[model samples]
Each structure stands twice: as structure tokens, then as C-alpha cells.
Target: MSPCTLLLIACLGVACPTLAGCDISMERQGKYKTEAPAPLFADGTSAQTPPDDTVAQGALAEEQAAQTPPPATPALLARGRERHDIFCKPCHGVSGEGDGMIVSRGFPRPPSYQDPHVRQATAAHLFDVITHGSGVMFPYAERIPAQDRWAIVAYIRALETTHDLDISGRPSPRTAGGRGS
Candidate 1:
């Protein structure tokens, strides 16, 4: 192309408003404005709301907050037993005596659920504690499934039914030779 013509084209290109810039300015002004109003979220939930029936409800103020009881099916108990044996029994003992192998070593002892305080705790409390854990115990919020946790709690309650121990009831291990060592 001619030098003059090329120079004129380059100048026009530099001076002309870009198609993208024009669209952006148009969007900022009329119905197709770029600064469209933000969508209002119901209950401040960012995602689209699920249908009414599917949502889980929180406990009411007047009602005692308790773990929603699982279906008292044999399957649930069995599952709970299985989970307890696998996860809890290792540290809590088969009888929930809190004298598992780990405790026999150097690990700190866990409390026996047979204690009056443990026995009196509501199901909701157990669920909260198991889900969230306390002290040396780590939260199993992600590790244990919600329903399975309830089952484990049920098994723990069962453990209390058979044992009669207390906060200071842990037996001191006697040395093989009957010495204080």
C-alpha cells in the first residue's frame, strides 16, 4: 500500500474507539448497561435455593437440642458397632473403659463413658462432641459420616450400660514383680 495511505490507516486505527470499548460504555448506560444491578439472594445464600422440603431445619429455641435419633434399626446399631470397633475402640477400649492399647503405652487416657456425667449427657451433646471433638481429640467432622457418627454414639451409650467406673476408677498397673515400679 502507499506510505501516505498506510500512515492514514495507522492514525485512524489509533484514534478510533475500539468495538469492545464501545460495547462496554453502552452497557454502562442503557438497558444493556455493564453495571447491571447485583442479584438479590434469599437469606443471603449465594447459590440458588433448593426447594422448601429438602432443606434441613435447625433446632427450635424451646425444644431441647438433641441429636435427632436414628431409626432404631438393627442395621444402624450394627453399623454403629462396626464404626466404634474400628475407630473408637482403638483408643476408648472395647468396653469404653478408656484403657485402650494406646493408653497402656504413653498416650493420655480417654475418659470412660460409664461415668455419671457421660451417661447423663443428652444424645445431642454426644453428637456435638463426637462431630466436633474436645481436648486431645481431633474433630471428626469430615472423617466420620453424619449418620455413622450417630451410630457410634449409640454404641457408646450401650457401653455405659454394662460398666461401673468413675473419673478416678482407672486401675493402677502393678509391676510384674509386685513392686511400685
Candidate 2:
């Protein structure tokens, strides 16, 4: 109410907090935040690349039972097919040829899994793509677990093998202009 009292309140607002060691020093911003510029670093990045042999917590190496998949038994193949149909078939097609329903609906078609280049890619490489995603394709690491990704890779390999088998051993698919079986 009095001018002295009002002046006292104003002074306390600034002085008391500082005296109590509750000033805004902690709230002062860091020189940089995540992914921000860093004049101190030679590379000019706030983040530094991890040294070799450094692994992220709970990474692929730990998640997968083995870097190389186990035997592609019938059960594994079946599960692969199921997972593929659920997550991959929308973009990778039932046969892994990059012509899925989404591709038909104006989405960009992916490279065919049956391509010779794709066939040459290592299983681990395929797993990496599924985990991190390729160009234009989003990652499925969350939707498809590490094991299921292995299964999908196995299934894609199976598709490639089937296409390479002897022509006479299987009923030939009709050409585009020809009738279906």
C-alpha cells in the first residue's frame, strides 16, 4: 500500500531470488542444441561421429539372433510370407517385384527384388534396408521386427530362386498378351 512497501516488493522480486541461489543462470541456453552449428568442432557440427566399434544401445547386432539368418525351414518361409504380405506386399508386391498395389495406385515403384543386382546384395544388406529404409521408401524397423525382416529377406530370396528355376519344371506364366492359366 505504501510507496516504500511497493518499492520493497519490487526489489525483493529481483534480489530475493538471486540471494536464494534460484536465479536464471540454469536457464541460460547452451552454446548449441542438438544438431546445431559448432564453431569449436573442426567439422562445424555440434555432434561428433562415433568412433569405430561404437554401437548404439539396443542395436541390430543385439536384436537379431545371428547376423546371418538360420535355416529357411518351411515354418520360417510361411512366417516370412505372412509378414511380407502384411507389411511389404503393399509396396513390394506378393512376388517382391516392386509392383505392389501401392505402385499401381500412383506411388513410386521400388526396384524389383528379383533384379540381378538385388539378388547379388547380401542378406545383411537387405536387412539394413528394411531396418533403415532405402531412398524414397520409409523404414519398417518398427512395423517389422528384426526377425520378421530376416524372414522377408528369406522370402525375397525364395522368389528370386523360383524365377531362376528350370522353365519346364514350372508352369510358365502367360505373357502379357496371352491368356492366364
Candidate 3:
């Protein structure tokens, strides 16, 4: 061993044990943060997907929402409209026509709300797409809160129903994968 390192190590070995109140508790938890990756997880993510049949804490409201959707009141639609204008309008247009400002700027446009598939889709389906994303759309689950996501779904549904109140139970050819959208 190098004499300098050996001397320093000997000094620390003696001094550290002799120091008062120099406790390093092994029981202390690590300072792991919400967004930080946890290598201990098999998937290497701090945020794990809930197991198939289990609803995570704070997620019961969303699960209950799927089962007992509230009536679409005027206030709810207004809230939905406000949220949609802020989040979805960039790619869905003010009227949900898929010809948003971003579309003019060459972003991949989302499907129009007036499409039969979207018009007939359930509110839960809208929530899933908004939260999880589909095709070229990035998931907004992190950006938009769950309630706001549901509100956007309501607004989209409003737009669809405003145009075609008769649309229901009919599957669109695009949804059926026939290549004609």
C-alpha cells in the first residue's frame, strides 16, 4: 500500500470510530423521487403500471367514473370546451375537424370528431385515448389531470353529437379496418 494512503486510512479508521454522534443509519430510506427511475423494479421504472385486476390508490375515482358517468350538464360541457381548446385544439381544431393549426404546420392530424367511429365511441374510449394516446398522438396522462382528460372527452363527444345526434351503435369502416376512412 502507498504510505500516504495507508497513513490517511489509519487516521480515518481511528478518528471516525472515535468521533461523537457520527451515526449513519442503515435503516434510513433512499431519497427516491416520483419521476426518477427505480432500477430495483423489473421494468426499471419508478412508476409501474397497475396489475391487471387491481386499481391503484387514487384511481378508484376513475374506475367509478367509468361505471357511473355523470350526466353531461352545460357546465361540464363548458369546462370540457375550455380544456379541449387548450389541449386538443392544436391538433383537433376548434371544431374538432382534424384541421388544426398544427396540421397546417405539418403535424400528423388526429381523426375528426365527426367521424362515425368517434361519434359512436364511448366516453370511456375517449378517456383511454386521451390518457394513453393512439397512433401519432402522445399520451397526455401526465400533462392533463384525469378529471381534465374526462372533460376533454366530454367536449369531443359534444362536438360529435352536435353534428350527428343519430350516430350510435354503427361501426365505422375505419374502425373495422377496411382501409376506407
Candidate 4:
């Protein structure tokens, strides 16, 4: 090995022993004693506890809930209809009957909204499935915005409400899946 390489290795070996003893000290109580350092992540941010805001804690959730528009807004439904027709209809069908042109061309049969399995799903479940996607369905997270995903959920609810038929004397709930009557 070169002299420089050997010197570097020797310097590092000597430094490691001394560095092992040095600890980070926080300046408090007028002391310079060794102390455990605050946890530092690889990204260089300290993993310290965040301060709690009383007003923002409970109030934020309530405020967000209040500020959030209803799931079944007409505007959202319209937007969802447009997005659904553009992106989902090729496979899910124009009316969400799950028999789109793609399916007719052997892309596999899509699930009909009126089907018993779909009828049992809550709106949250449908939204999650739509956002994350299910078997053979790619996730729409990248293509669909967060609010628009909810809008699509609203549109799907509209489909279920309008197209759902009574079967075995059970009518599907009118609201989006999961919301209590």
C-alpha cells in the first residue's frame, strides 16, 4: 500500500478509539457534561417529540370535517363522471355495468356495481379500492388527485343508487357505502 493510504488507515484507527468516548452534550442547567445525543435520522433531522397544540388537536379534526365538502356533491359527481368515463369506462363500462368494450375484447370481465359483492361494499371501501385498486386493476393514486378520488367515489355511489335493483328483497343503501343512515 502507498504511504499515504497507510497513514490514512492509521489515522482513522487512532481517531476511532477517541471518537467512541465523545458524546453530544445539550447545554442545560449550566453544565458541559457528556450526554446522549438527540436521535438523528440518516436524513439529518432530529427525531424529537413534536409539541402538542391543544386548539389544533381536537379542533383541527372537527374543522377539517366541517370544511370538507360532502362526499356526494353534484360538482364532484360530474367531475367523477368525466374521469370515470375517460379512465375507468374502457374496462368498467359507461354505466359501470362492468362490461366495457375492453371486457368484450377479452380484457376480462369487470365487476358490475349492481352485483351482490359490490353492493355489500361501503363507500369508504369503494374509495379505498378505487384509490388503491383491486385485482387486475392498477392503482389510480398517480392519475387521480386525492379530492378527485373522493369525487369518483361519489360518482360510484350515484351509479349504485341509480342502477341498483332489488334482489332477494334487499335494496342497496342509497348513501355512499359505509356512511350510516
Q: lDDT by residue for model 2 over 1-181, one digit each (tens)?
A: 9999999999999998789975557566466888989999999999988999987876756475536577888888888899889988899888787989998799999888867678889999988898889898899877776778888888888887776444675535543343221
Decreasing lDDT order of the candidates = 2, 3, 4, 1
Candidate whose lDDT is highest = 2
Candidate 4 structure quality by residue, lDDT tens digits, 1-181: 9999999999999999899877666643443233434334343334434557536445555445433546576787999899888888899898888888998788888788767778788776876787678999988866776666667777877887766334443455663363222
* Winner on TM-score (1 vs 2): 2
Expressed as tens digits, the lDDT of each residue in 1-181 for candidate 3 is: 9999999999998897678556567656575578798899987878878778886676787656545546778888898899999989999999898989998998888889877788778888888888889999989887887777777887887776554322464545444543223
Which candidate achieves the best TM-score against the true structure?
2
Clashes by residue pair, model 2:
none
lDDT computed for candidate 2: 0.80
Off by over 4 Å in 1: 1-67, 164-181
The count of backbone overlaps in candidate 4 is 2
Of candidate 1, the 10-residue stretch with the lowest lDDT total is 58-67
Question: Could you give me the TM-score of model 2 versus the true structure?
Answer: 0.58
Query: Which stretches of candidate 2 lie above 4 Å from their native place?
Result: 1-68, 166-181
Tell me the whole-model lDDT of each prediction, alpha carbons only.
0.70, 0.80, 0.78, 0.71
Q: Clashes in model 3: which pairs?
A: none
Q: When superposed on Cα atoms, how far off is each prediction in RMSD?
A: 12.7, 9.2, 13.0, 14.8
Q: Output the better candidate (2/3) by lDDT.
A: 2
Q: TM-scores for all candidates? A: 0.53, 0.58, 0.57, 0.53
